[model samples]
Target: MRALRALRPVQEPPARVTRITVHRPSPPLDGLVELIWAADSYVAQAERERVLPSGAQSLVVHLGNGPLRVFTDEDAIDATEVSGAIVCGARVTPLLIDTALGPTVGVEFKPGGARPFFDLPADAITGRVVSLDALWGASAHSLRERLMETSSPRDRVRLLEDNLLRRLARSFELDAALRLSLDAFEGRDLTSVGEVNRRTGLSPKRLLALFRDEVGLSPKAFWRVRRFRSALRALDHGTLRGAAVAAEHGYFDQAHFVREFRSLAGSTPREYLAARVVGTDHVSVRR
Candidate 1:
């Protein structure tokens, strides 16, 4: 038998490091959390990271580095840097973030995941970013202090999960309601809001209320993100023909898809695909 050759683990470069890490939450969080994750990058120059909407809200801690500048579709003039920890509201428009600030670690809550924990309605913060302290009060400030004491990324993540787990709301059917609302969205099985209400056995007003309080974006808006995400995926995979992609995804026509795509993505499908960074959700920026 030939001597086995030893294989060395491939190491990612240390300097100018860019990375994304996702951690699995224990037990009960599995249902509500899509994944608890962090996005980190270190480089001399600023990176324009285009964060697309997927109908999820992010609970972010800047990790003592950033004040990431954020711009929206409206102003394109004024930019805001979120301080300490921030909660990003669910949005339909693409968010332009300047990542020159520093590394960030945060949790991207699954749609409807935020409602159970916060007494405030999810819609209250839609299309906005508010400090964690505003929602979690003293605990948010304390968590920041604890996280700063640890240099290890792993420790920071654990600290975040621990704090949130301690604050998990008492078990209830809130999860069930959220699940039913989302189920109608799975695979575009339900066509419209009325269809979701009918399938979920929730009336129009009740479903609307639940979505406003639990999911931030209403069922209609949430589905738009879902649909947009799907189209982006297809386009990224070299769909080539925008028309075919639209038709397959249930868009009324090529024009319809283009309009909707630009509405959420801030660019035509073709333009976006042209600028995308391969294998990642983010688009490429000129250095």
Candidate 2:
């Protein structure tokens, strides 16, 4: 899902655009899904956009003209079209999105929280986008149809939540150790992976295994993503230059920060800030 912030639209969207709505799920569903959002934008001003990783995975069901197409590389070559209802896995690299607009309703899964929704281990699809049909078969198509048939955003969110609750896969459970690890690693900038292992009383190898099984990324890797997010937050809300931001986020120095940010976000801090689409992690760019 998009970050939790008030959006100032960079430009007026086309007349057909639906106002973006973000809704949080209730109770048990809230534990897994961070937020459900719906929006309609039939045309994109840019040919392609680079979406930075949010660490969490998301399931998006298209309700408009076409399915989402993402490019694997910066050149915008070799684009692959995913299903209308697809699950995007936790990733470290930027997603090169073809901004051909598709009205979409999406669910953002919390860290290690998507395990109960899919039969396979979370790590199985890390850094990749997989169709829900591949996991749920005909049920996925049915769910999308129902979503498309619903006009109200509220009804659509409720329908999606009820479907997820019913479709909960029992194959994997988020054990206590894994839960504790996520708690320790997520948003705790000062907490080291070693510290988390110590707190959980698990060896590094064993802990990493748990993280991969449930969280789709190693604890250190997840922490790195979270740190990048924190840096982004700081940059978004505060006036911090690269060196200051780097220091704030525990990088060795500005150079170290630049390298890591480039790896994860595909841009230097300044460039990313300059290109960022207000109210979103997407960096606007042409093909």
Candidate 3:
């Protein structure tokens, strides 16, 4: 048998211009964190891009000149400046972000897996880019300061892992029902959310409430996100996109898939593919 690989590089910044490295946590953390990534580079001009939803939560620490700016939508006009670090809540909408002026480190937490690390309910932050200081308080600033002192990307990544380990809530535990539902859904059930609900042994209302608290998305929304991820992966891999691909990913048909794509991604499938930055979910948009 072939040896198993740990972290797979999802995106490689344009060669020579910028470099980004992604690492997967080992063991316990692996169950929650999908990956830890760091990027260091400087662009003479401001770069803006739209980051598509991945059905996950993110915590990013910026260690550079200017603060991170998140735009309201695809227009890229209205914006909010978020200094230092931010917790990007699990969302179904696209996030428009301004170019980074300095080095940055971030963590991508698996769906419903961020509970232990956060103090509040996951749904509270949904669709919002919250300042990390709001949650971690002064410690968030101190963490960014420490990251800024480190020139080595490897060192920064290690620091992030250590901080997460220190902050991990040992007392927090996932509801047994939610855990079971996640297992079934992630196992590629490719069926209906109703089936997943039944498997959880909870009423539809009860299970939905649990999901909102833990996963930040309703069961149907979460399933749609998951299905979208699969379709995107297939399309990115050069698999021809059409009704066949849609059915393979559990969409009712090509039209059904297209509607969901527009809703979550803010663009049609073809347009997204044309603008997609290779190895990343980022789409370059005109200002």
Candidate 4:
């Protein structure tokens, strides 16, 4: 199995549009791709914005004091008024322009990373955007205030993780089937869909449906993102050559990798890596 590692952001100056502060409780789950902490201080335009590439899903927790408007490529939604904390569930790549007031703090958990807590069938949650207040049966605002009051970042993260796990446990089982499947996909060559189905005892259709419900994308799509993340981490750590990384991760060739990377990451892998080297981090929303 491949050892899990952290991808540190380049410590350059912050970008002009947004400011982010991140906290990590521990190294991310092995099959999980990425995790991020982000905050914005002002409202953004309603114009379409590509927040993340295809295949990945995100969860957004609002720590602001104003309402947030979430717009997909085709629709606009007035999310809960930001008085407290709200957790947006998994979603495919879509335009997420923040049409709300500033001081928005949220965490973005990547595809595999989010799967541990949210392993449900996509149909169970189709077209439903839930407020954390509704899900927690309390005002999100109060919960967030309590969380923010904790001074220690580590403590805060542990608290957040505990809350998330508790909430999700009410809906899904946290057991070996999901954990082992995640571990099987890490670092080794990509496994076939049939093999995954056999090991997990879920039909391919059922597996994809469940993944989408909780994680917000199909299993095959999730696998691609996981592989992409693996290559990106290698690039970040300077541990693999470009071609070697591409071939090892199951890309047909370097061009195939580049095309897939650009489609999902909104830029070529090299360009994205270059930007990361300069401290332009990525942001994603979870509606």
Candidate 2: segments with Cα more than 4 A from true spot? 1-3, 6-18, 169-173, 187-191
Name model 1 segments beyond 4 Å from true: 1-16, 44-47, 169-173, 238-241, 277-281, 284-287
Root-mean-square deviation per candidate: 6.4, 2.9, 3.9, 6.4
lDDT of 3 by residue, 2-74 (tens): 0012243233344324456677888678878888877766342236777788777888888977889898876
Task: Give the range where candidate 2 is weakest over 10 consecutive residues by summed lDDT.
Answer: 3-12
Count backbone overlaps in model 1.
Answer: 0
lDDT of 4 by residue, 42-137 (tens): 332223233443333444555545665555443555433334555454433433445454444445554434555444543344334455565455
Per-residue lDDT of candidate 2, residues 150-216 (tens digit): 9876678778878877776333346888878777775436657898888889999999898888888
Colliding pairs, model 4: 32-113, 53-264, 84-141, 85-140, 121-210, 121-213, 122-213
lDDT per model vs. reference: 0.70, 0.78, 0.78, 0.51
Deviation from native of the Cα of residue 81 in model 1, angstroms: 2.7
Indicate the worst ten consecutive residues by lDDT in candidate 1. 1-10
Error of 1 at 217 (Å): 1.4
The sequence of per-residue lDDT tens digits that candidate 1 reaches over residues 1-287 is: 00011111112345334455557777677667665655444442235656677797878787655576777643365788777888888889877776575556677677888776677889999988888889889988788788777666666667778777777854433557668778778675456778887777888888888887888888889888888877777776675467898888878999999999888877787777766544344553434
